[model samples]
Target chain A: GAGVSQSPRYKVAKRGQDVALRCDPISGHVSLFWYQQALGQGPEFLTYFQNEAQLDKSGLPSDRFFAERPEGSVSTLKIQRTQQEDSAVYLCASSSQAFSYNEQFFGPGTRLTVL
Target chain B: TQLLEQSPQFLSIQEGENLTVYCNSSSVFSSLQWYRQEPGEGPVLLVTVVTGGEVKKLKRLTFQFGDARKDSSLHITAAQPGDTGLYLCAGGRSGGYNKLIFGAGTRLAVHP
Candidate 1:
């Protein structure tokens, strides 16, 4: 069985540039989550999706962050006018069910550096 | 805001030694989960403790949930070098689509 996968293992961008990170959740997974992890820190929740519907976006830090899962299986996180503070590893995780009680499978994550 | 605090931010020990990592919070949670993450990789789920005072074991690792469901601990017996990684604790609330609140994490280094 395949686990969650994120693309562009590493990315470097100018401070004002926009960047998009993609995530492919495990097949048949109904719940997907996005988290941002700073260096030497724990991952912070960004958003969550149940199928194609975005259920939670309160964790997103600011209006610059946007995420969508239109097809219900794949998701993309876009950051506009990236800031130096936005530098961190973007992690994607998915679970078989929509409940948090279910164990989540995580992807390697995309490390983004804003200079 | 629900916040999880992990103690002993960093640990270094020789192989075969025993170690424990703690996660604490003032807020009660519906469930708590432990994860181990290696460099250049995402975290892998280790165990989930749902009941108050519940304990679960996985080989050399033992996980315990606090009686009030506000804390958790992970103990490793005779740890090996392979056990080295960043240990993270996450708490799940009763509602809100199962969003998780995570701790800063403890980085463990086990030298063989």
Candidate 2:
């Protein structure tokens, strides 16, 4: 794909169920990030990955939230035992640099609805 | 706590009018970026300001960063219907891993 892409544009999960969202960043991009956004609000940072190594997970809300980028190109965010408050749009973004001013390109985002 | 705050959460204006959106923060950032997002898509980068007290213009849009690198303002001149969308401001820290701290955002509706 020419830009970042996310799978399952919309997902509905019952409370206490687990869900995994996938992201495919631009080819060869080094930095990947995950964010959660509520309706009519801005994105909140979740985690960050540089290549295949997870560098920052400070923004993850709880121990149930997990993310990984095994190959540096594709990434996944897993939420275990979801709650009602967990409903939000999960966004993925990638940049060409690790910690620079390079522009971060974003994906369409996966809207997760917890029922 | 929200590190950055945006004012006028919702804006509705007529075409050809001008408006300004503000993003304020207490902490400093290495660089600030502006992005526009549609209803069903991702945010697209508009511009980035690296230096404090810097100003950048994109066509009818003008962006300014505060001298302390703690705030930013976006000014749109002669807005059109095409300018309607959610506008976001994100900041990157110098020693961080390029993780963006974002404001709540300002949703602008330019009606023709």
RMSD in order of candidates = 1.1, 0.9
**Candidate 2 colliding pairs:** none
DockQ of each: 0.79, 0.80
- Please provide, for model 1 over A52-106, each residue's C-alpha lDDT reduced to its tens digit, 9 standing for 90 to 100: 9998899899999999999999999999999999999999999998865899899
What proportion of the true contacts does each candidate reproduce? 0.76, 0.78
Using alpha carbons, what is the TM-score of model 2? 0.98
Give interface RMSD, per candidate: 1.1, 1.1
Candidate 2, residues B31-101, lDDT tens digits: the string is: 99999999989999999998999999999999999999999999999999999999999998887567788
Q: What C-alpha lDDT, on a 0 to 100 scale, does residue B54 get in candidate 2?
A: 100
lDDT for each residue of candidate 2 in A1-115, tens digit (9 for 90 to 100) = 5999999899999999999999999999999999999988899999989999998899899999999998778999999999999999999999988866889999999999999
Residue B18 miss distance in model 2 (angstroms): 0.5
Worst 10-residue lDDT window for candidate 2 chain B reads: B92-101
